[model samples]
Target: MERGLTNRKEVAKLAGVSEATVSRVLNGIGPMKETTRERVLQAARQLNYELNAVASSFARGRSGNLGVVLPHVPKVHLFSTYYFSELLGGIGEAVHAKGYGLLLLFRDPSEAYDYVSLYRTQRVDACIILGSSAIDTERDAVHRLAEERLPYCVMDQRFDHPQLNIVAADHEQGSYEAVKHLIDKGCRHIGFLNGSPQYSNSGDRLTGYRRALSEAGIPWDEAAVYEGNYSRTSGKKAAALVYRDLERLDGIFVGNDRMAIGLMQGLRELGCRLPEDLKVVAYDNSDAASFTEPPLTTVKVPFYDMGKLAAERLLRVLADKASDPCPQIKEKLPTELVIRKSSGN
Candidate 1:
């Protein structure tokens, strides 16, 4: 047994095993006999030998890092929003459990960013892209990733390309269920406060709203729809817009809980009674949804679950890259409608 805990040679000598065996056990790379594994582990414990993760990754021709790319919006707190926060939490949990490092990278949607270079530069073994909007630059980047056959997954965005991998919530179904709930309550005049169309989910949600109206044999009123930026301030503004048709507006379906909360507050200030005069249903079912004055009736999109699935799917792609060069995966998790006081149900 060597006195200093410097190299694998010392551990191997103490364990009476080859240095190759020590490397295998330490790096967790190859399958080994249980008794040999225990012997190597025991020797490492005695010598306090710590594996050098960076060196091991290089030796195996890997970066040992999973990259998460988020849109870079200046001065806007990304984590403050429930969508980004929950998605990140899920990705972090999965990456940590996989014993791989997470490397975060931000790309400005206004500018061109190379998504494929992360794998090319050996910065990451695989990547997951979040907050992909309908911006041309962002779309170009995602397309480049797919064209390059990179091992990556895009969360909450659907490119529909056979080469692209996606994990997202069924936002259209969620929106349909919400609006149908309102219609079942005998509300014919419903207003939709929607997020920006730059997000694919926004379009999907709109599709759902229209589908519900069509199914109910109700005419779609373009005048009652307002575009919000999925922010509290925009939601407040949306409430004022809806007020113009206050007499006709019997129910409202908001795109997200953040906007819904703001809209609710603004409507209250405008002297409108909730659920009695105007019922509301929102999406995201965030933590704040339940604590609102009348509680929120919301569509629960599983952002956390989507994130976890994206991360795990990216890992699977990386693991099978050698044999299966290009893997196409598109997974849509189901959403649930949570009924509460806001919906008058």
Candidate 2:
């Protein structure tokens, strides 16, 4: 298994698969079993095989562009949103430094699109998916990409498939810290406003919220928990429901800054004072967190770093640079709590 002496046949033999299978596995080809993929990659790493070299010799031509698939939500300017913008900023930087083009793709969740066709047609060298949700269609699409053996990674979302690569923030811990911060501020009756449960992070937040409450000797009350779509408007609309619980709920943990901002506005119009009437803390330390009425306290997720790390590693692997170790596909970064006046700090 000498680095210079290694060949495709040797890799296939060691992996106990065919040479063609090795080629498909290395180049990101399609519709294969997870066991086959694991075997090929493990053999490749073991034999010190040049994955990109074999890919170039056997795979289709490179498109010199990295495709970023984004979920298309109606009337929502994704670029205007701090979450997408920061993540893209990091991806753009990595793609540019590598002298590659960045292709922004939009897909409506209701519709179906073949992600592999982008590779088959030579449109993108690799892919990084954004706004992915916990859906069967999404699972199928990424699974197709893995079956095809193409280099790709998912951001801020989780899938049950073991072969799929993921880069995400420590959301559960972020949620826990936000709730704990409120508890430490002496708020006995804490409320939680979480996003829809379609995404795993929503569930993570709920788990963290419950954990903090349980640890603090507070009973878990379903009446105090509300749900929003992680949108400003949804937050505003939820204010009425949250308002009703004001007598018993003294402090609240919001899912994101946008929702917190909207909730604060709705509360003010409904005759509630800021910080004094209701202490608040939110997730995603977006730019507007500071500009809010009382300056919002929130959790800081390393989105930019998440994007950069995923893109950089995938691109480097695509270049067949054996100097860097084989790809570490799944990663979760830490989150920090930024204390501010909104949390009564």
Candidate 3:
């Protein structure tokens, strides 16, 4: 019995079954009789046969692969960006462990139209989108996936798609808690540095910051709010603008950890003492937060857990374990407040 000598046709001939039946048995597809399946398996073992992934998938009418759409991965330092890397790592681990292949697609809004065209072809068995950036432009692709009954899930953003499943952190509550913590630490004149207001996460985080201040009877000062672009440089520039323009700011809440680090460095250059002259708090508790001159106080989101859960849910849907059509699953994972020197906590 020579290895690689037994192809599907040979196995079928030996087992006295059709090539399709042999294919189904080898690839774990069901509906074949027990005796027929055992006969095919026994033949395979005797022949030392290995299934060709491409051929077997073709026979089964599937690609045996999953598609992952992440918006602009390499454009930014995603690995250094904690939230993106953790989510991607979790997704990669879960998919690889399941013995299926993963196809990563990274594109900006303009280039995302190609994915929409691909969805029309029904190429992949299922898909998982990493962030909302892709969805903002490729909404039609998402709609097409739903129309085709293809399984998919959103990782970190909440879109109002009736069919899509979502796994995300509790950004609203986390931001609220972060702001409240600063307030409890005797920060009265708190400033909010935000990212783009178009994204749902940015809006949710802003709402949380506002809600926390309102609850604590602190007046919402529009002058203290500065908008950035979710970049470290943006944070540095915003800090300069705030320091040079605004006066009497006792605390600052940055939208993300990268921005917070930039702001902190900027403040230090301007002779602003941490937790003494101005307290600082940020979101996304990235690794950079811990390495800042004074370790940052921020909200630590379970990004990896979110990725794992999203992958698992998508697999369940693809495997036909989920019976509900167009199931709307909203999973809200918890976030923790990591205390360090930044907030003087």
Predicted structure with the largest lDDT when compared to the true one: 2
Candidate 2, position 228, lDDT: 100
- What TM-score number comes out for model 3? 0.80
- Per-residue C-alpha lDDT of model 2 across residues 1-345, encoded as one tens digit per residue: 123324888888899999877766666544458798789878887877886564543354566688999989889998888889999999999998976789999998876668988877878878899988888888888877766557889898888776778899999989998999999999889999999898989999999999999999999999898999999999999999999989998899999999999999999999999899999999999999999999999999888989898899788877774533335488999999999999987
In order, the Cα lDDT scores of the candidates are 0.85, 0.85, 0.75
lDDT score for residue 333 of model 1? 96
Report per-prediction Cα RMSD to one decimal: 7.0, 9.5, 6.8
Regions of model 2 farther than 4 Å from truth: 1-59, 321-328
Query: Across residues 76-182, which tens digit of lDDT does each residue of candidate 3 receive?
Result: 77666777788878887888787566777776755544554444454555677765543455666666656655567767666666665678788899999999999
RMSD to the native, candidate 1? 7.0
- Which ten contiguous residues of candidate 2 have the minimum total lDDT? 319-328
> Clashes in candidate 2: how many?
7
Cα displacement (angstroms), candidate 2, residue 246, comes to: 0.2
